[model samples]
Target: KEFTYLIFPLLCFFYDKNTRRKEKNKRHCFLSVPRWVSLSLSMCLSQTLNRSKMNHIPIPITCQNDTEMSSRDIDYTVNALEVERILNYHFKNKRLVEDALTHSSYTDSVSYERLEFLGDSALGLVLSIYLFLTYPNLDPGQLSLLRASNISTEKLARVAIRHGLYRFVRHNASTALDDKVREFAEAVSQEDDPLIHGGTVKAPKILADIVESLAAAIYVDVDFDLQRLWVIFRGLLEPIVTLEDLQQQPQPVTMLFELCQKNGKQVDIKHWKNGSKYIASVYVDGNFIASGSSEQKEIAKLNVAKLSLHKLSDSRPTKMEGLENTGELDGKSEIEGAKQKLHELCRKKKWPKPSYNIKDEGPSHEKKFECSVQIVTADSMLSMTGDEKSRVKDAENSAASLMIHLLQESDYL
Candidate 1:
């Protein structure tokens, strides 16, 4: 009799799932079952239902247009519309949006993993096309750097936090995801730069995943129009980094290497663990310049690099006189008379004079001169090599031009 009672509920559930859509009136027929049995079945369905079991036994899950939805369904739909308002792009299918926000922790329905995968690809393509069109002269390498900076885990996670997208994520109530997200939010609130990656608190990947999944939902809803996707979400991705922005935030490690190379000195950065924090020590020519420690190794490296720059700055030569200050530096002057301009900049900045190195190549009739220009900053010496030219003077000018451009990009100018 106990077995019969258990089996009866399963039969009733299967019947309810199969008949609920076909004949709405017949759905009530399962209500005729005993109260305790109905309660037990409802509890089981709510807790254990998944697609794999549904394929085997046909458990009734909610349909797209079911009039009688649970309170949870209504909440998800409302959240979807709110997100639509935030994104300024209405979804034809609210289900996709709901799915995007639904974390794997939520047991009732689909998660955003698949949508995130699609969105990741779509976002990359859209950003690539935008960069290519917007910056006609940028090399593929530079374009790639810009795209990466914009879509990085830190960048996208900041987007989610900045726009309150994190509020829409549906996760298990028992999980600690909310606490971690709150902690991250609090940490980033103090940051001045929205796109900065190296911070005291690392960005939780789930926040980034939410942005990607939402993007995928929009892409799918709009029939995969790459341009339309950009048009819709461009505002959300505000303050997109441009070439100038990219130049402003130079990689400290690369700059350090270039600086040491120009000075004919070797550079080395050593990493070690000091208790819970990571420590990075910057060395030039086997001498320790500065050290920085952080919770993350990369952040420590960057900190040390900045410190090293300051240290080198203090040891640089005093400013030389008699060079005219050409107001603010621009690209045209850097190319027109790069050699003289570099000398003027070195004088104005109170740094060491610029030095040029030349290499001759090819046969005498088709000879070429490759020039490398070097200059000392406050803490380090930096070098820039120009394209080979037929004459030594032209090569020297080219090298100086490249050096000026490097300084501009690195914000040294």
Candidate 2:
């Protein structure tokens, strides 16, 4: 899990025509949008200021009920109300926010992976529009940088954090206890640390992802009613600036560091075989994140790691292809990474030594090969199965448990 703030109330800055915010704020407490965002938004307003139609205005919230939002919850709470207000303000579409917050870590009854994908693209488009229109004066390079800066994971996570979004996240307990959500705590309360001891990191990533996915949702929702979107974007951004200024710089993913939290996640050299091809897997907390069968594992690791990192949100859209397809970074794959850090526990116990072997065990031997993982006594693998996942833990029997975990794990490729 990665770890990583505060600002303007969206209400004051966004809706100049004033209809809902005033009506809304009295009934509920909405989260704040950071002042930094205003810089990009202001740039857009500068250009549209004179246009009677484009200048600051207000539009209807469209959604009167949040049933769709609540349905996404595994255990609903008042946070659904918070999501409702934010979604209403930004997308004027509540469904997107609900989907973005869905976590794959939740029980089978809940998970938001598909929604996360859609939201990811949606945020990208919104960021692009915010940059382009805001910076009528900037060249392409400057616009790119500015957009990248705002849309990066760090920034997006901050957006979610500032608004008290994490308190609403759904995941196993370990994650809820992590510092991953600290940055998202309100002005008063602080969240815990950002490392997933077990399977909870999934929760934090989903929360961070919702920030951008929701942004994307707002963009798409706005398309049907541009004026309404503009007003909401205005409230969300008002504390930042005239839209024109936001376009002056570029936005980059590097601005965010929450993804860099203490999971022992890092890029390392690794190799695997897919038919005659060589592939690589990136590991975090001793678990495979994304893997590739490539001639160059280093580059493959980076590409897959980046893609997996980008896919943190449940709202994100992921493509499926067989494992053999992942070796090429440009191609898509249906592969899933390691189950959780149970593999980390095994590695900690040093139950199995790391060994790289290259033998073409034919497909016919798949079952026998899997069963023999422990017979070789070389290494153990751990994975998360939906039902029993929570039972695997760092415990009194951790050493033996580690061995057991490794015996069940799968190497990513």
Candidate 3:
């Protein structure tokens, strides 16, 4: 009888277990959790994935509300089709390109500043290398002058505008692009037909900024290889970059003989002509020793030659100890090793130079007293002359010191 009772309970327990499972499964079916969740998750995933497939080319600023029919939309400067064409030509990495076209003014979420920084550096390196290899005989100063002029913001902007960059740039919804940039660009484009050019010009700075941003965009895209950059650069600089023309670019030192060895064209540098009537002058970086201007191209060329000679004269250094010998004044190392040596010698002779009046000048723990000693020692130059034993050598050293000072001031060093 007991066995029968236990079997009955066991049977009941098995029935209960099956009942609970059925109820749980029934709940699952009613909620449709598996089907619904899967669908939502998949849709979200697809949008994320599709972003990669679509190139970042901008939609036309004019097409913001494209009912497909109105040319009256002047709300934004750049158009979608123009952006698409430019990006399609230059960018391979769709994702990278999108990031580049996105102006900070367009949205608060992302920016291209980092990409801009990177692109600017890359362009500079590439252009410098091109100049180096192309003008193998050119001196360092000449190469740098060419590179700087070529890679300048204004030049880049002009290129961008020619390639339809203005079509992609979006201004604040409220403010149209500055009128100056528009006017200058129009004027340049329509040089042959001033009435058609509308005499509109864009601000040089604005145009350039947009161009740099575009370069950064192209850099992010995989399609823009070194060859592509070179091609673009060559086309843009074609007017000025011929072998013969490069010779006319300034040489702060004598490079005429070496220039002659390059591809033979009459070594002439003429003022570069764009649609604008602006003058181009050469300087070794920013230090200007000469200026030249003329209506005739050869006249302008002669002026550059004279300027190069002037540059040579201005730098006529009596103390041209090739960088290896500038000692403490070498290049950018401003540390005063000689001064410290002098101070130690003075200390040994019981003539410890006084400490510096100011303190904490650099990265070292070099005390204010050490700097003061240097200053005081410099002031005590007269006292050292009095010692008769060292009088003759002292005068000679003083004369040498005076010569060094004179050389520094003369510019003909």
- Every model's TM-score: 0.54, 0.36, 0.38
lDDT of each: 0.73, 0.41, 0.43
Best by lDDT: 1
The CA lDDT at 394 in model 1 is 88
The C-alpha RMSD in Å for every predicted model, in order, reads 16.2, 20.2, 26.9
| TM-score computed on alpha carbons, candidate 3 | 0.38
List clashing residue pairs in candidate 1. 312-378, 312-379, 313-378, 313-379, 319-350
**Model 2 — which ten-residue stretch has the worst lDDT?**
367-376
Tens digits of per-residue lDDT for model 2 on 1-413?
01101222343355454677664652242323233344333323433443444344543223433334354343454565667675556333444555556565666433556546755665556567876876788788666655554554444555565566666666665644556465234311311212111111122455556665555456555543444555565454323322333322101122112343423335343567677567766555565556544343333443454444433321122221121135322222212322133334335643322211111224533411111111111221221112112112211122233323334333321
Q: Give me candidate 1's TM-score against the actual structure.
A: 0.54
Scored against the true structure, residue 281 in model 3 reaches a CA lDDT of 55
Superior candidate under TM-score, 1 versus 2: 1
- Residues 266-298, candidate 1, lDDT per residue (tens digit)? 989999998989999998888889999987676
Comparison by lDDT, 2 against 3, better one: 3
> What is candidate 3's lDDT per residue for 179-282, written digit by digit as tens?
66665675466332111101123235556556566666554453346666655545543344443333322222234323222324233332576453323454
Worst 10 residues of 3 by lDDT: 378-387
Indicate whether candidate 1 or candidate 3 has the larger lDDT.
1
In angstroms, give how far residue 130 of model 3 lies from its true place: 1.1
